[model samples]
Target: MENPPGTIGPGWLIKVSSRTARPDPGACPTHLRTAVRPLVAAEPPVPFRRAPREDFAPGPLFAALDLWEQGGWSIGRVLDELRSTRGAFRGRNAPAHPSLMAWTVQAFERYVAARHEEQAAARAAGLPPTVPVRLGWTARTKKKDAPDARGGQQYEHTAWGRQYASADGSVRDLWIPSLGRAKADRAAAEKAAIAHVMANGAPTPHRRRGDTPPEDATASTRLPERVRVFDFGCADGSVTPLLDWHRTEVQNRFMADAAPAFVSAATGAGTRPGASCVDCKAISGCAALHRTPRLWGAASAAPMRGRRSVSAWDLRLHGECPAQYHLVRQLHLNDLSAENDGARRGRAVDAWLNQRHADRPVRGCRDLPIPDASSLPAAHPLEGPLAHVAVRMLTEHRVLCPLNGIGSNEQVLVQHRVTAYVPELDVVVLAVPDLLYTRRGDWIWRETKTASRPVWEGRSLLRSYPQLALAVLLFSAGALDADPRRSWVELEHLREGRGESRLERIDPSQPAVVAEAREVIADLAQPLLDDASYEPTTGRHCHGCQARTWCKPGTAYVAEHPQGVGRHPDAAEADHFADRGSIHA
Candidate 1:
C-alpha cells in the first residue's frame, strides 16, 4: 500500500498541493522522504506541559495550582507526576478534566518561573529587574475640552500594579476573561435572569446561597427618602440599578446605627419613644405612602389621547409628509388572517353579532330567567352582541373606514385628579373617553341584552366611553383621591385577543407626559376636521395606505424620498449618474 502525500510514519503534514509537486509513478523512497521533510518541518507540533495528580483534585485549577505552589514541587517533577496519575497522554482526544487542570497549573507555574529567572538574570548583571509599576486606569469624568491632557481621574489597582491595569477602569474586568465581552454576556444573562424573576420567579444561574437581596430590590421599595424621579426613555433603566444600590446602602447604614432600637421595637421590648421615632421618621415621611394602591382606582383613569388622527385628511397628509411624529403615532394593524390562523376572527365575530340581531323582534321584557351563555357567564360575557359590537366597531368602523383609521390614533385623555381625601397620596389614574363630558361623568358602559344569549362570561364589554375608560378614569380617580398607594395606567389591548397589556405608571409632576398626551390627541383628531391642505405623508404609511392609488402625496413622497434617502442630494445624484454610465459603458 502507498502512503498519502506529506505523511511521515503515522503523522501528516498539512500543505498546499501543486501540479508540479505531483508524485511520479514508481518514485524512490529517498525522493518521497525528501518531498515530505520540508512540509513536516514547516509546521511543528505544539509542546504543552502536563499537570500532576494533585492538581487534578475536584477543586478549581487555580486552587490546585496554589496548593502545588505551596508544596514547592519542581516544574519537571510536577509534570511527570501529573502524567503518571492522569494516564498516558492521548494527544487531542485526552479527557478535558485532567488536561484543563494540567494546562492551568503548568501555565501559572511557567509564568512565575519566567519572572523569577528574568529577575535573577537582572540581579546577576547588577541591574534592576523590569518590574511592573502601578498605573491607574482612566475614566471619563467630564466632557472633553480641547487642551485637557488628563481627561479624568482614574482608579488605580494599588495592589496589582500596571500589570493588572484594565483596558477600562471598571474593577469587574480584573476578575473576568475577555473582560468587555464576558462582562457584556454576563450582564445580558443577569438582565434576562432579573426579567425572568420579575415575570415568573424562575431560578437563575446567578442564584447564590444565603439571604442576599436582589439587585433591583431597593429600587422596588416604596421608601420616601430614597425616591428619585426619572424622565421617560432615560438610557434604558440605568438609574434604576444605581437607585436600588443607593437605597440598599442607605437602609443598611440606617439599620446598623439603630439596630438595638429596631430589634427592641420588633420584639415589643420597652424602648425610648423618641429614640425609636427618630429612626422611623424617614419611613413615615416616605412619598410613596401607599405600598399597593387600590387596583380599581388605577383601572378607572381615562385613557390619554394619543397623537394620531383617525380622519381622512390627517391620513392623507401623513401619507404625504410621513414626519417622525406621524410615524410615531402611526398604527400598523396586524393582518387578522395571519395572526388568527386565517380565520378572519374579528370579521367572523362581527358577522355572528349581526346575524343574531337580524331575526329578533322588539318586545317588552318585564321579568324572565336570563339564558346562561357559555362558561364564566357569572363573571362576564363572551361572544355576545356586545362583544360583536366591539369587534364590529374595531374591524369595520375602526379598521375598514378610512375616516376612523386606527383606534390607536384616537387619544384617550387621562387626568390625575384628587378624588379621595388622602393628603399624602396625590397621584391617581383617570380614564376618560372624550374631552366632552357632563358634571357627573358621561355614561360609558351601558348594559345591553344579547339576542341569542342572556348571561355572558367575563367582564362586560366597555360599550361606551365611560365603560371603556373605566379602568383608567375611575380607578385612577380613586387612587389620586387618597394618599394610600402607587398609581399606574394600564393600556389593555383587547384586539390582540391575547390579554396582553402595557402598564406605564409615572409621577404626576412629570411634565413631558401631559405634553406627549396632548400631542397624540392633536394628531389623532386631524382627520376628523376639514383640512384642505392635508397631504398624505408617504414614509411608512404609503405601503399600508388603503387609498394609495388616490393618494397623490403618497406617490410624490416616495418619489422624492426614495429608499436609502441620503442627506446629501449631490451624492445621490452622482451615484445615479455613475450607475447610468456603468450600464452604458
Candidate 2:
C-alpha cells in the first residue's frame, strides 16, 4: 500500500542521536530543549564514509515515546495499555516515574492542537486532502517466563492504534513543568510538544477520531504565532524555558563566530575544557591532562590486560613506544609501503626459503634449489644480493647448527607458526620459528633475522632480545612437556656470518623468566590496557618510523628541526620495521 503524502515514514521518525556534548566556552542552554548532542558516542557503528542510521523499532516504550510526541494517542489510553501489556527489551522506561507520564500527557495534548490547526488551514485554503496525523509503531508482550531471574514482561502492541484532533484544533491548555527530566529526546520527539507547552494557558482540546467529533465539539485548533521550549531536571521540578525555533536562530548566528574545536586527547592538543574529557578514550598518557587511567586494579592488572592475545612483535613495538604501538600495531594506520628495495629483497628471500624447504629439506645450501631471478619481480631490486645472503646464511647454519642433519623418525618443522596461552601471564603468546626441529634429541626454536646487526653483537643479548624471550615462552608452552630442551630459544643472524649463529637456552624454572616475560607484555599493553592512551614517547627511533609522519611527536619534531636530504633507510630494514603482529591476535 502506498503511504499518504506528508505522512511520516517510520524510518524518518527518529534522527540518529550521537554523543554530541556541548563545546565548552560556548553559550549555555537557556532552555535545555536546544541541546543537539548526546551523552556518549554510542552511535551504532556504520560503514566508513556513511551516515549514521538506527533501525526504527516500535514496541511499548518506543511506541509510547513516539506516539505521545506526535499527538497520536492520549496518556490515559496509553497508561491503560501499559498496565495490561508488557514492553520488549525494556530499559529506562520509567513506568512509575510521574515526570515521564506527566510530560507525555502534556506533550500529546499540545501536538493534537497544533496538528488540528494545520488541518484547519488546509480546509480554509481549499487545498487537496492533507494527510491526517497517524502513528507508526509495533508492540509485543510476554510469551513465557524469562530465562533470567527477573521475569521479563512486556506490553506488546497488537494493532495500528491512533487518535485524531477536534474540529477547532487551536492552541491548548499546555504546561511545561518548571522541573523534572523534561528535556527533549534529540531524535524522535518533535517541536510541536514544545510549541504547545511554551504557549501560555492555551485551551487543550480533547482528541477524537476522523469520523467522530469530540465530546466537546466546540474546541479551537488555530495555529499559534510562536512556540517555546522548556527543560526539567529530575531533581528539581522547575521548568526552565527555552527559545523557540525563531529564538534559536539568533543563538546559532552568535555561536557561528567560532566553531567548536576538538583535538585528540592522546595528542594533548586541546586547551578548552571539554565536557567529554571524562569519557574520552584517548585521555590516558595525555601530557596536557597529565593523567594515566588504568582499567583494572593492580590485583587484576596482569590477567585483565593479557586476556586478549598479543604477538612477539606487539610486545617489541610497544616496548619501543606506546604511541607507535597504537599506530602501527594496534590501529594499523601506518601500513608501510613495499616500494623499498630492502623490503622486496626480504620478501623474495622469504618466498625462496619457504619454497625450498616446503618441497624437500636440503641439508646443504649448494644442494638447495635456486629459482630464476627474472621470475621474482621488477620491484625487487636486491634479488642478487638477497639470493647470495640467503645462501650464505643457509650454509653457515648447516655447518654450525646441530639440527643440520635429521632422520625420518626425528620431528622437524619449517616456517611453522606456534601459538600458546601463557597461563601465568594470562596472555596468548605467538611465534613462528623459521626452523623448529630436534637435533641429537635436543629441541630448539630458531628465528632468522637479516638485519644490519646480528643478535650476538649486542652487549646484553637478553636486554636486546625481548622478542626472543617471547619465542622461548611460546616454544616451552607449546612443548606440552613440563620443560623441553630446558626451554631453548635461538637467534640465527643471516648477515653474511659476521656474528656467531647462537642459541640461548632459557630456564623456565627460574622465576625471572616468567617475571620478565610478563613484565614485557604488561609494558606493551599497559597504555592500551589503561585507557588506550597511545602518547608519543618522543625519542630517536622516530627518525625512520614510517608512521612517524602521522605521529604527533614526529610531526612536531620535524616541524621544529627541518634538515637536509635526511636519512633514507636501505631496503633491507623495511621488513624489520613492519609491525606484523604474530600470526594470531
Candidate 3:
C-alpha cells in the first residue's frame, strides 16, 4: 500500500504505532490525532538531538544480541569487543558517555544471563529452543475498512520492541526493554500490540533504513500458537512477562476490542495547545494555542540557545538548585522513590477536585455532598488520616469552586494548558491553571492548592505561589483574549481544617500587580536562562529531589543531612507541606 497523502485532518490513511496508538486517559486527544494523521510538510520537523547517554544503551545492547545470535560469542568476549570499540557497533556516529558505556555493558551482561535462564527453563519444559529475531510486524486494515471506512481511508498498525521466536515458530516473545525499573504498559495498548503483531507476524527481522529485505520477506505461513510479551529491566537485569496470549485470544478478544479505540484516537479532533504545540505540524495555523511573547520578562543574553520551555515548577526547582532542574527535568532521570505522605495527599486532593469540576453541565461543587472517609475507593491514593485530610480539603473546596460563578455556556477549561513564548529568551513559558473560566467575557485563572498549614503569614502571594505570578503576567499581556480590565488571577488555598480555605484574587489590570509579577518571575527565571552550568545547590529541596542519586553533590548533602532537614533559617521555616505540583499536569 502507498503511504498516506501529505494532508493533515481527521480522515486520511491513518498510520498508528500500536505502542502509542491509544494515549493515556488524560492525554491530549489532539496530539494523538495529529501524530497518526500528520501533514506531509515540505520540510519535516527536525528531531531533537538528545544527549549521548540517552541513546547509548539501546543501540549497543541490541547489536550485542545480534552478535551473540550470529557467532554465539561468550559474554566475556562480547563485553571485551564492546569496550574495545567504544560502542561503534552498527556504524553509530554519536559519541557514548563513559558512564553510559559502563552502564550498558553491565546491562548487556544481565540481559544475556536472563535470556539464557529463560531458554533453560523452556528447554526443561520440552519447548523448542528460541533465537533472537529482529523483525517488526505490521497489520493493515484495507482502505474500505478504515475509520472512515466508506471515505476510503486505510489504517496501518505496528508494534515496537525486541523480538524473538522459537526455532519451530510455535511461540513468539516481544521484549520491551527499560533502562530503569520495569513499569507496566497500559493494558489496552499491550493487548493491541499483541493483536497487531499476531495478525501479520513474520519471521523476518527489522531492517535499518535503506536495507533491502530478504527474498522471503513475507508473513509466516504458520502463526505462533502462543504470544508472549515481557518487560526487560536493564537497570537490575529483571525480566517480567507482561502478557501471554493464545492465537484465539488475540483474534477473538483483543483485536475486536481494540479496533474501535484505535480508530477513535486516530479520528480524534480539537486542538489542545500546550507542549505539543512546540512540535506540531499544524501549529502555525492552530487557533487553540494562545501565545504571549516575552511573558516571563526575562531575556537571555545568549541568543544561540535553541527554543526550550519553562514552567513554574521548573522555575522553582532552578531557583532552589540548578542541578536538580537539569537532572530531573532535562535529562529525565529519576531514582524511582516513593513520594512523601504530604505530597501524595496534595496530589489526591487535586485529582479529586479536578474530577468533580470536570463534571458535565457545568455543575458547581457547592451543593455536592462530600464522600465519607470509609467510602473512599481502595484504588484512591488517600488513606488513613490522609483520607480524612483529603475529605476535609474537599469540603473546604465547596465554597471556592470556580464553577459556582460560571454559567453553563461560558467556557470552562479544567487544568488546560495556557502557553506563552519569550522571544528574547528564546523560551516558551508554560502554565496550566487548575481551573480557567469566563464570566461576562472576562477570563479568570484559578489555582487550587492543598496545604496542611494556613497561607504563609505576611508573604507575597506571588512570591509563595509563582504560578499566580505567571498567571498575572499572562492576563496583563492579554494572552487569554478576555477583557483585560476585568480579568483576574485567583488562588484558592484549601487547608486541612474546616473553614480555613482562602480565596485571594489579584487584579491583573493594575500596573503595580503586573510589576510585582514581572519582578517575581524575572527573579526566578533570569538565573535559569543565563546559567549554562547547572551546579547543584544543597538545601531543603534535596530531600524530595528524585535525581539526587545521580547528583554527587545532592547525594553528599543528603548523607550529611540524614533527617532531610535544611539548616537555612529562611527555607527551614518555609511551609514544607505546600504543593509544588506540575502545571503540565
Q: Which candidate wins on TM-score?
A: 3
lDDT of 2 by residue, 172-270 (tens): 222232222445532112232232222312232333322222234223334333333334332223233343343334234323421121111101223
Model 3, span 29-135: residue lDDT tens: 56666566533331233334333323334766777777776668877888887777643565554544333444557778888888889889878988787677755
Q: Compared with the true structure, what per-residue lDDT tens digits does model 1 show for residues 1-585?
A: 122232323112211111112223322222233232222221122123232112222133333333344456666666555545443332322232333334334444544554466447546965433332122222111222331221111110011111221122111111111101112222322222122112212111222322223445323322222211111111111111211122334345323432322222222212121111211212223333222232222233222321112222222233334331122222221111121111223334333322332222311111212222331122233455544444432332222211122133232221211111111121222222112111122211111111222222363222111122233333333332421123332221223222222222232223343344333323432232222223334454344333333245544765766672322221111111110000000
Task: Report the C-alpha displacement of residue 580, candidate 3, in angstroms.
Answer: 9.5
Task: Write the candidate numbers in order of decreasing TM-score.
Answer: 3, 2, 1
C-alpha lDDT of all candidate models, in order:
0.26, 0.39, 0.66
Badly placed stretches (over 4 Å) of model 2 are 1-309, 335-343, 361-366, 369-403, 422-426, 454-458, 475-482, 497-528, 559-585
TM-score: model 1 vs. ground truth: 0.18
- What is the TM-score of each predicted model, taking all chains together? 0.18, 0.43, 0.76
Worst 10 residues of 1 by lDDT: 576-585
Q: In model 2, which range of ten residues has the least summed lDDT?
A: 10-19
Error of 1 at 3 (Å): 99
Candidate numbers sorted by lDDT from highest down:
3, 2, 1
